[model samples]
Target: MSTNTLAPVLTPERLATAYSYSSYRQLIDELQAQGKTTGLQQSAALTHYTHLNVQRMQRLDKTTQVVPELREAVQNLQQSYMWLVLTEGWCGDAAQIVPVLEAIAQASNGRFTTRYFLRDENLDLMDRYLTNGSRSIPKLVVLRVDTLQEVAQWGPRPAEAQALFLSLKSSGATHEEYAEKVHAWYARNKTQATQQELLTLVRDLA
Candidate 1:
């Protein structure tokens, strides 16, 4: 099994004490208002931001960022699946992916909701959902809200993101070059331009 080597102390006590449910809701609302059916590129940026929220990271720097494509997809979205985002501060998988998913959810209205599962604190939830008998972090499980159907899952990967790394290996690339390729691939793959596309994709899976 892979492991996290960052070893940055999470200051769990501080994090737990400072947790604010209302603040999280407000952030979602804020992002939603800013995101409407604009274009795929903008949708991509917003989705990236949403994934960051789930990872509990600070927002990206705007000067280096592109304008997000917002669409009015939220109004017509139908909730089909409930998503469980299991994460930790030091886990790279959570860092890169979860926030984008959260952004997509906000764009889709309330079609999606996420609960943060801090593995250090929520071991029971981790055991029920993730834990393949080890103590790693960052597991995302998809469940259909109405029928409780499990849709898909992926995670506990490292900064190099194994799946992404492999996908970038077809050419003679340096490590830095590979990293750029992986980031570009991930960014493009996550964004959904229209409500119809989002609905069709999620519906196919659910």
Candidate 2:
């Protein structure tokens, strides 16, 4: 059977239940206190990642400077869009990207708004936008708010980060080694790649 057939249809009703960026962060903070992680799987490693993710998010939330080009592109948008993102607190990629997304949306005035969905809770939606058949978090689905139809999508990681991840995985690097390198790349790039890519996406919509 085709993989597409396995995914659930995304309805507006379903989308409405997703969390706001603020609420999603709050959920993570709340979960952290309980020593829990999102999704069905629970482990010390995952929980540790979740805690690290929160710190990453907090740092990014404080420091992510939205490029003027992206802000202008979003502000010029004639149509409003729903920036639906699939993610998890333990996802390092999501940790680095989602806050930048939120900052962009905030700069949009009201034309771009972000909604956060936990990947484990929204597997059906995540199935629709897999990367190499892997259910990668931080998948963005840009939807026209008026019609609720998808216009563009992006995710999992920026191109450079994806490349680094692939190289590490193929080279038999330990998971810790792989994660460290990828995150260090993010630290150096400092959201520039992500913002530039999203700027292109936003411009096309205008």
Candidate 3:
């Protein structure tokens, strides 16, 4: 990757507060034990979702693989990068996506490091990364490690899943209906699209 010409988006102080993947996972478990979720405006529904997300993350942790294309992409990176992810425990997309990201980073042979930031606790950063003007969780902001300058980003959901979401919404599908379909899509996808898209981003960074 070439030297980033843009200003750094994250201050060192902020980056220092981000948690490792293991810490992030432990946090969710700890919070769940206390009947809590990772964000403000908590309720039984949010807590329930958090419970579901934990299971999803656990399954993904055990199953999501770093496809050869993505592994090769990371193996070829000429510069190091940091992936700062904004997420919340109740976020289904984050639950399904974060583990895949961790898997990829771990397989990357030290080419990349990933950190987790609970979205609500980092509103100042989250505000800068809105998707279609909405606060979307699981936003991955890639930075050139040396300068902390952002190279690119990927998140919220894969394009196909996003399209399904929008279609269901515009067609007046119920919230439950859309949610079921979107998550079912994630179940079938099994992280392939996520890895492929990230692979494209990694190549672009190169």
Candidate 4:
């Protein structure tokens, strides 16, 4: 299992201290208010992602549907686990993916819980699970709640979506082109791809 030696492993106590989804929502609200009064001092990427995250999160919260298999798998979980996600408000991928994770946890009926940590602030942990040495956002670190041993890790994007992204990157696509394509893929898939993958991961690990 992937482990972060430089940083302390997250315990339930530690995870509890991180932002919950509701707290994350409040944070975005505050940021939006700040942006309206004075120009957001953050990078353009960060500002744009913050706005996009609000919209994406709201849409997911309203529309995300957990598949029966996923629900059943989670419902049958014999062990307690925590999904410690490393992400940031400015990560577009995180905006699209995190809500689905939240939905899954809720469906598990307390068998699972999720917490968020900013990737930039948790560089030690992020570095331990780098996707090919890059600090990918929205890295899901699944751990057994009892022992805190790492179980499985998933991140950044689904397989098909990541493939599309790599294809565009290899072709030297512009950032706008790449992002548009990725966002379009997410829109078309509507979290189905992500749900299925997580189902498999959770089942195998469980």
TM-score of each: 0.45, 0.94, 0.96, 0.90
What are the per-residue Cα lDDT tens digits for candidate 1 across 114-196? 55555656666567555457654556555555544456544554333455665666566776577567556545543232223
- Candidate 2 local lDDT, 132-169, one digit each (tens): 99998799988767666777888888999999999999
lDDT of each: 0.47, 0.87, 0.89, 0.82
Clashes per candidate (backbone, < 3 Å): 17, 0, 0, 0
Candidate 1 global Cα RMSD: 12.7
Off by over 4 Å in 3: 1-5
| lDDT of the structure predicted as candidate 1 | 0.47
Best by TM-score: 3
Best-to-worst order by lDDT is: 3, 2, 4, 1
Backbone clashes in candidate 3 total 0
Which candidate has the highest lDDT of all?
Answer: 3
RMSD of each: 12.7, 3.4, 1.8, 3.1
Q: Which window of ten consecutive residues has the lowest lDDT sum in model 2?
A: 1-10
Instruction: State the lDDT at 151 in candidate 2.
Output: 78
Model 4 root-mean-square deviation: 3.1
Candidates by TM-score, descending order? 3, 2, 4, 1
1-206 in candidate 4: lDDT tens per residue? 34444434765576667888788767767877676211224676667768877899899999999999999999998888888888777778888999999999999989888878777666777897888789887899887777777778898899999999899999999988998899999999999999999998888866
Q: Which stretches of model 4 miss by more than 4 angstroms?
A: 1-8, 11-13, 36-41
